[model samples]
Target: MRKHCCTPGQTTRTPSGTKRPSVTGSFPADPILPEMVSLAGGEFLMGSAEPHAYPLDGEGPVRTESVPPYAVAATTVTVAQFDLFVTATGYLTDAERFGDSLVFEAALPHDARAHPRVAETPWWAIVGGADWRHPAGPDAEVDAVRDLADHPVVHVSRTDAEAFCRWSGTALPSEAQWEFASRGGLSQQPYPWGYERDPGGEARMNIWRGEFPGAVSTPTGKTFTAPARSYPPNGFGLFNTTGNVWEWTTGVFDQRRRDHRAVIRGGSHLCHESYCRRYRTSARSGTTPDSSSGHIGFRVITAK
Candidate 1:
């Protein structure tokens, strides 16, 4: 099976050395709340050694990874938090600037018109007017789910994530920092919590509980993104580190590849054991820097 993050498709590669947007806005006067957890970084085996691991995705060999002490968000950035940034800076997200974004076909209305699909992943549709605010399409209103403001923000690109990081006075975690933190001080474990996906028949994460690209059987009744704290946190007090949404990291997908794709970790609500088993701590995928989709978001870290 071909390895894919979530929305798999070809993207126009950007030239190297393109300057990222400069940081703007004055720092918040009040100290941001202690929503971040400080980790005493150390060495741990990174990647997977399972026979079923996808070799092409480079999810194996179980090499040791070391990271310095740092702090990471206890949860992914939420819609409310992002909204504040937008309101303050009037920043336009990549999806907003592009006028559309990739949405999971399942999220659209049944009567929605057929949109162009990614050749490799037909479940993804290019929905016009789809962005962080209009997650489904033009007709959907974010106010409908205003109660879910604590849920992780979606339809954001690397550029948008970087901008958030800049404004927040934090930075995107490096791949090593992400993996090391996600491991939760565990060594060579498949997941952050433990060896089993669910310990004692309880779901530890918010991954697909049913057939992928079709039905959702999550007992929690959460079909798409759940509240950031929907499930129990890992050993490091981090929530949704394995699933919920694939998170952007500062690492490149592959140093050898010439494309501008960046590394994305965790999985998403769409991931299932039958296919797209990327919810493990070491599992990884990539997307173009400019690409934005409903299943991709990010977290930030502050180095100590």
Candidate 2:
């Protein structure tokens, strides 16, 4: 078995001058392939100043941000959609090229072990053969998950997402654009719906329902990602903007950092208020460009 390791803050880098994968197929020019929702963008306050915010994340000192009118996909790029890209471009994802990706320990196979654990975040395991195709491990396939084709594609790196965007004639949303859309026309609201995390005593998004890294108490009975549109759309008709998977953004996560990390907004099903607490529109995290994990995915937007 091949072994690969990286520190908590570092990522496995692909060497320069590597040839691009050969194209095996192509996708038709269908303008309506990805249903997009038009947003009449305007100025809004960005970031957070809440007392509960994580200072190190730079989610404070909120400032006004403006976005031009644009159209964003109503939902994240799904596995089936990504598959179409892969088929058209024959593109090898970073996870595939690197031979591994990070997997949540909870999703690992029962007998799977002997993997490197991230020192700072032990919940993540570097499992060989863990890629978009095999999200959990070598033994697990994405098809095993019912309706996975409609679920947000995870285990994708920023580079992979960019390639998909380029192929589809779209671009990754900026941090401001992503936040603006996630808010669903609400200003400074903690969640997409409103101030309440679970309005009407019901789950409005996909997130950790009970204990973190252990017990799951979701009222929806879903321990992992729910299908796209499983939950109600935000006021803007965008789905799963706050939870399900962290969406990549074009904004730099930290200018002081040298690893070229980009901002990832929203949060995943692993997010828990007691732990990550990043499932809000204002929350943000940084990950290296080449990093691929089960919780990270992305959506695309086109300028109007």
Top model number, TM-score: 1
Tens-digit lDDT track of model 1 for 172-282: 999889998888878878888888988899888888886776664654343388877778788899998998999999988888888857889998888888888888889
Residue pairs of candidate 1 with colliding backbone atoms: none
C-alpha local distance difference test of each model: 0.80, 0.79
Badly placed stretches (over 4 Å) of model 2 are: 1-10, 13-18, 22-32, 141-147, 216-223
Model 2 agreement with the true structure over 198-252: per-residue lDDT tens digits: 8889888888777766755543343277777778999999999988888989988
Query: How big is the positional error of residue 160 in model 2, measured in Å on the Cα after superposition?
Result: 0.4
TM-score on alpha carbons, each prediction: 0.91, 0.90
Q: Pairs clashing in candidate 2?
A: none
